[model samples]
Target: MTTPNVSTPRLKAPAEVASLELNPHDLSATLYNNDLAPTTRKGRTWSSYSIFTLWANDVHSLGNYAFAIGLFALGLGGWQILLALGFGAILLFALLNFSGFMGEKTGVPFPVMSRIAFGIRGAQIPALIRGAVAVAWFGIQTYLASVVLVVMVLAVAPGAAAINSNNFLGLSTLGWICFVSLWAIQLVIVSYGMEMIRKYEAFAGPVILFTMGALALWMFIQAGGSIAWSTGEAKTGADMWLSILGGGALWVSIYATFVLNFCDFTRNAISKKSVVRGNFFGIPLNMLLFGVIVVMMTGAQFKIDGTIITSPSDVVESIPNVFLLLAASTALLVLTIAVNLMANFVAPIYALTNLFPKHLNFRRAGIISGTIGLLILPWNLYNSPAVITYFLGGLGAILGPLFGIIMADYWIMRRAKVNIPDLYRTSPTGTYFFTRGVNFRAVIALAVSAVAALVLAFSPAFAHLSSFAWFIGSGLGAVIYLAIAKHGQEYKDVSGEEIAVAPTH
Candidate 1:
């Protein structure tokens, strides 16, 4: 809650100013929290390696493993699933670059970045939307990680099953214990701040990759070096193509939240090249490799046990070796904790902080996010495949338009130029303080595009096109925003040099 009055004369260069160097002192108290301020050059310490490991940790999560293997259960062939993963990874890379570039260039978080398109107060639309999604995912991931803990608990003490059998509020007593334990662990870890999180990601990412490789190899050997290819109910011709496209869309939808708030991480990146390199290696290549291993492990398990276990945690449970079980359980904990904090936890903290900058800093906002995550009863959301599918589809529909609108405004209309001080200004003369601090054009575009996308995702007639909700929503949002904004004063182009010399007003 402390607002320092330090002079920031060096903030003349938007590209060079970091969080501490930015002139938040001259801006409105409501809009200029240190947590939401631009990261200083000194603050941009994340290297390409940091980004690579970050993505590695992101890919190695229990949720992602279950997500990838679930494609096989959804009638996708192993090869088809691999294709879907690759397609999603490539598309994700491109979209991440779009968001990451803005973060790197301007050193701003996602909610603040949205200000360029959504206006000052109007930016809260996307910010709150993203915060809600992040909270849900946070709860879901905590539940997923707790599943791993439950496995470890049962392994150590069989009597825990009796406790697990007794249910309340859609979760068992044992399940609640495990969930709260993992939640507390994550809460403790993230409380140390982003520097500690970054270091942990760098270490955990490689360990996870190695552990997965070993597990896959072990599973392959256990199945006598043969792969099970005919495990799914395969589709042919047009059905097959639709499955591939839809499956890829589903994969992309899983990371839709990450794609939007990628700036939260990229703002810490040392350079744009670092972000690109990290994403290139971490996303497409890492995903393809991880997918192949997932296929190997699951396909081998099918061959060995005559049935496939979709949940990676369940797969670990079946291992008779106590040592291997403990090791795998530890890996799963590390993997989930890394991803939950980096992906689910950080975004919401920033979003909530943006909502009331003067009252909330990172740590306080993080506690609120975690509390909300627990209150949502996330276990119910992850109970069935149908629920999961519709939930993600609906989420993508809402988030897609926001992405398109922000990217369109920044890359298309603004030409990558942003006025640094203007972003924090709340005065009538401020460029972003339009129409009483709200941009109705962006708001209208979001409402129209999200509603149409939601209809496509949920309506019975358009159910077949449900998977393309994100694409359709984003495309429509961009088109609609551009059409309406072209005739307005919102599209004014401001250069970097102009931002450097622009008055705070």
Candidate 2:
């Protein structure tokens, strides 16, 4: 009996083992986890640089340039435009820093982090809303990127102009060809996944910076040295300040939607320090430099053409040398496509999958979302100014409240302690489970703020306050949620793995 003595192996519970098993149905959730984990401490520094490159790609694009100059076209002078750009960029910087901090502290993506505020299941509401908006923008940006491809084709084979003669739904045959081709190109790039995107940005960021600088210099030379303000009529200082504030607020609001979700990418950072530093270099410095270049180029083009040119393509076309014009156009095309891919394409792919973790995996969800975006193309729904304004404004309204609620809940209410494991569990005992998977305080805060923002958006009486909708909504939501949740009830005790919130410095 003594000789037959044996040792027993420890048996692990099936439920414990099951948690570690990879579920193909939840590929998006898996990717989200992979994206959030800091695999190496050294890689943390790259996060900031990656985010900085992201903003560089975002700010230096043709559309952003056009938007900057469009402010001047609103009867504001060059100085006023500069003021607006400065103010708007600063506001965006601040908001992005706050949002990025959450990612850095928790090592979680935006949709997952949102579960803390909106609840585990309720997070789907914001995810779907964001995904829908992203899909629409993705289609529009793809269309814009195709413009360059079409131009290159026409330049090489002049016969291609004949394709433009036959039209369907306001688009020529050549335009449709370019659009589909570019769309397919983006799809292929996205399919390669996020690592490819990082490499693409590393190259695209510097290339765009160089080409834009060269184009600005060429424009200045063509204008014969100096350029003056192109304001058609002079205005009082008071009027100029008013215009600047209005324009700046509008720009900030337009940017606010994306800025709130900055964590989506930054969560991959290996360290929080890198993210803050990267945002510092990226937002204010990069944007200010890009804004200056845009203003200078627009001024130079104004002097030469005797009419203000808002679009970067218009500036490219103004160059007398055909070769230089072609070069600039090609660069703008590359820059546009890079930004469109980063900002629009990747976000929705992940977001949509988050909505149906048990049904659509990442690739399948991306396909579904992409297909829906294509279906929306024939209507040209994205082109309508009224619709675009409403879409952006409505998103801003919801996002503002969401941001506020998350900040208040994390920093003010919980004192920044998040139970990481509980985020994945649907048990009533989870930290995020509030009233059967919905936080009523957050819901009410969002609803109230949204109604106020919508009123500001649609009612002429509140038109004067419309530009500040983002700020108003966020501020109100944070205050209201804090007031409600502060005295109401404390969250239930969950698993005791306490993660410290990074201190606000």
Candidate 3:
């Protein structure tokens, strides 16, 4: 096992490094770059318990709660929705487990690991794609998180919601403050590094899970015998079956963004077993619990308020008791911070940092990524289904294909044997160097799959297929990539075992 040399000194910025290292004749071009190399061969530092809560933290966010609400609203019964969610969660588990194995086996992040299938140069295709998705979600989540903060303000002042008459840039003065405040808080938390993040998650994950359960119980009591077992959707026959399948597809698609970048987290897990065990329990079992909470809570809201309310902030606002609202909002704030920093923010920060390692490490790249979130005007985008559908759906259309291609290249073609150092080499003789560092083959596979999926996503005639965008795109890309690549090329590792290495030049 090899490790990336994190200590290697880099130039101050890309400009200085470009001049010094970009020269075609320079030895620097082929030499492994410190930031992009395979590092941290040791596995299993993070226990299964840590891994479990890590994902639990992801589930506990308001965005997820809201997403579950929308899925439930798709006319599936509560039990039907759970069953659908279970199917989706199982698939998610299988997908993340593969990514986790790669990460645990190699100890590199998603972008670096993807270089195997995409070529070190071509790998940027998936890197930027996944990173862009992460950043978009980051913005959406930041805006979502700030709702709690804004609610906190309203809970305290009670009259501040009236100040919305004088709003700016689509957000009221108070809204702007909360958004920026959460944004800054995220930066501060992210600036502290992954250890700090895990620590915060350790504390916050269980709190939010417990809080959600308590809220569900409280609301159920308030509804007072009105809590119905029905999900308000079809429960039997063909309509119910279609609703279940359709809702399942949408449910899986929701987490497709995380599926691609999961290596960023898995690389830190203590071992392959830990990763597998964690995801199995974390995503499916824990997700089931949260689903119940969301369904119950949403049902309670409907009974009491005459409408389904999924947003925690909205529920807190309606509490009427300022003290309870204040406590609830503050608790939600902590959970949202955990979700943004750990799940949404960190991946893009690394993906972008990988793009220009000399100029940006995690901290610097993070600021730039966070700024992009602000520019996207997430306050407007967060609440809209069309925007969510386009951004997340579009990303899945491309990234799903990339994920398929990478897995096929690694697992099927290369037989899990990586010629580790060759992944970083720029020598013409190097394997991954294809036509000026880009694998046109991988690019082609991705383009075809993405274009087809996007057509479905954006077009009304085929829009129904958009719901299954992830499954279709990934399976299509895999088949196409396999058809295009050379076969029967047996590779071997240093110890003389027959192996499947990354697709090379």
Candidate 4:
């Protein structure tokens, strides 16, 4: 069993980086060897534009419009909310850069990458948790997008709403058909593979942007063509600051699922430089501009309707032009599917596939996520804004520590290095093969920190802190992991051979 030189050069033109030969000895079972394998030595040649559009695909959705408008509930004005959003984006950019650099360096999905910090098998703990969240959101996002289709049908023929209005489990029959159809469309995209998903989003993102701009403009004009911007006045000094930060947290939580597994996307990037550049364009800058349009339209909605309209469906319903309504709704449906395909669908497929790679190749795993998605009753989740916010907050709370622990394990503890072969090994002697391929310290760190954070999230006594769950949980997880990891799980090794014995068992 052997690998070509481990000291491969990086940060070169994609043309210069040769593809890597599979390391014969380090290969794991076919399950581990599924799409999660660290064998993609020369990743797809994604330029800065691809990464930039990645954020566009990631963010350009109905949810982005809603989440941005939701921040107004915190009573922060447009400029203040924008400031908080930018701050969160800058910090997020740095975090993604750190993780994405690792992906570009390692050429593995997030689950496989976690093996460096979480033990080889233990990595499933975080992987499954992330996958579960993605699946729920995948279904929820599908349902949300389908709502637009329903709206379009109703607008085309106002009587169409009653055709399938027989409500079952909170969703009408028409709603179910639309939701299921959107789900199937996403499955088709996943069936085509990741590159196809990228190509689809590349086209969809720009078109969505134009459609959104037109909608926002129309809404503004309908709202009297004047900016009587409210200061979004706060009741108290503490409330104002809280509003901004809370808005920031919601901003973080908006795409929190992706933060835990961004490596999956970055791993496919052409180079580290490209990933960083792409994130800059995609995340912060893109969100900044997108949020501005959403805020402007939201404020216009408040003035005209006497209440803030966060949902795009509500905004489209206000438009009298049948042609415009149909066009906007159709554009939104396409954009939502594209975003769901990129953000919600792919990560979980890879994450769940990692759990039992032998049985669940990417396609099969995607089918499982899709099938399970049907059972989650995502329509109920979407209808309950308070419930869904907490659900997202809970996800942020758990993921924060997990993210902190992994980053700590990668950067602080191991100094951005790992014995690649040991990652797939089952031998107790292997560095990542601790205690039957599970690192107790990492597990304990995640459990303790996440539990404490989430307890606060659900606690009415401390419910206010839920907005900062990501920040607090991340800090606590990092600190706890840092303190415990002082025992320092083995990384440097004797012999300096940079290879592990191929496991036979």
TM-score of each: 0.88, 0.87, 0.86, 0.87
TM-score, structure 3 vs. true: 0.86
List model 2 lDDT by residue over 1-505, tens digit each.
Answer: 3687678998869875675574322222522343322223233334667877887788887778878888767777677677788888888877777777776666566677777888877777666667777788888877777777787788778999999888787689999999888777766666666666776787788888888888778888888997767547745578777778887787777665576666666656657777777777877888778877877788887787777776778767666776777777777877887887777766677676666555654456666766776777823765687667687557756777777788888777876767665676666776677788778878888888778777777789987787777788878889988888745446542332132222110
In model 2, residue pairs whose N, Cα or C atoms come closer than 3 Å (at least 3 residues apart or on different chains), thus clashing, are: 44-270
- Score residue 228 of candidate 1 by CA lDDT: 88
Q: Any runs in candidate 3 off by more than 4 Å, and if so which?
A: 1-35, 42-44, 158-164, 231-235, 303-306, 380-392, 493-505
- Which portions of model 1 miss their true places by more than 4 Å? 1-25, 159-173, 380-393, 487-505
Report residue 174 deviation for candidate 3 (angstroms).
2.8
Q: Rate the local accuracy (lDDT) of all candidates.
A: 0.82, 0.71, 0.74, 0.75
Higher-scoring candidate on lDDT, 2 or 3: 3
Over 4 Å off in model 4, which ranges?
A: 1-23, 39-43, 157-162, 168-170, 223-225, 231-238, 381-396, 486-505
Q: List the residue pairs that clash in candidate 3.
A: 4-38, 4-39, 43-270, 44-270, 44-271, 45-270, 414-500, 415-500, 431-504, 431-505
lDDT per residue, candidate 1, 1-505, as tens digits? 9999988665345554553366433577798766777777654678889889988988878778888888888777788889988988889899988888888777778888888889889999899888877788889989988887887899889988999998899889999999999998887777766777788888899889988888888888889998887485687788888888888887787777888888888878889899999999999999988888889988998888778777667767777899888998899888988888888888888888999999998888888899998987888877767766676556656888888889988888888868876888898888888799999999999999999988987898988887787888888999999999855344443333222321110
> Residue by residue across 1-505, what tens digits does model 4's lDDT show?
7877678656756543432234445456732654775535443656688788778866767767777777777666777778778877887888788878887766678888888778888898888878777788888888877877877767667887776669888788788888888888888878767777778878887887787778778877877886435535633477777777777776776656777788777766778789988888888888887877777788788877668776777877776778877887888787888887877788788877887777777778888888888788888777788767677657656988998899888888888876766666676677787777888888999999999888877888887887777778878998998888756445662221233211110
lDDT of 3 by residue, 1-505 (tens): 9987688765578786687666433323332343344445432356687778788888777767787777657776577768888877888888888877876666556777787777877877788888887788788878877766776777578888787557788888888888898899888877766666777888887888887787888888889945655546455788778777877777777677777777776666777888889988889999899888877887777777668775766677777777877777788888877877766787787787668865776677878999998998976776778877787667767877888899999889988777765665677776677788777888999999888778877888986676787788889999999999878877654221111222110
Q: Which candidate wins on TM-score?
A: 1
Selected candidate, larger TM-score, 2 vs 3: 2
For model 2, what is the error of residue 326's alpha carbon versus the real structure, in angstroms, after optimal superposition? Answer: 2.9
Number of clashing residue pairs in every model? 5, 1, 10, 2
lDDT of 2 at 192: 67
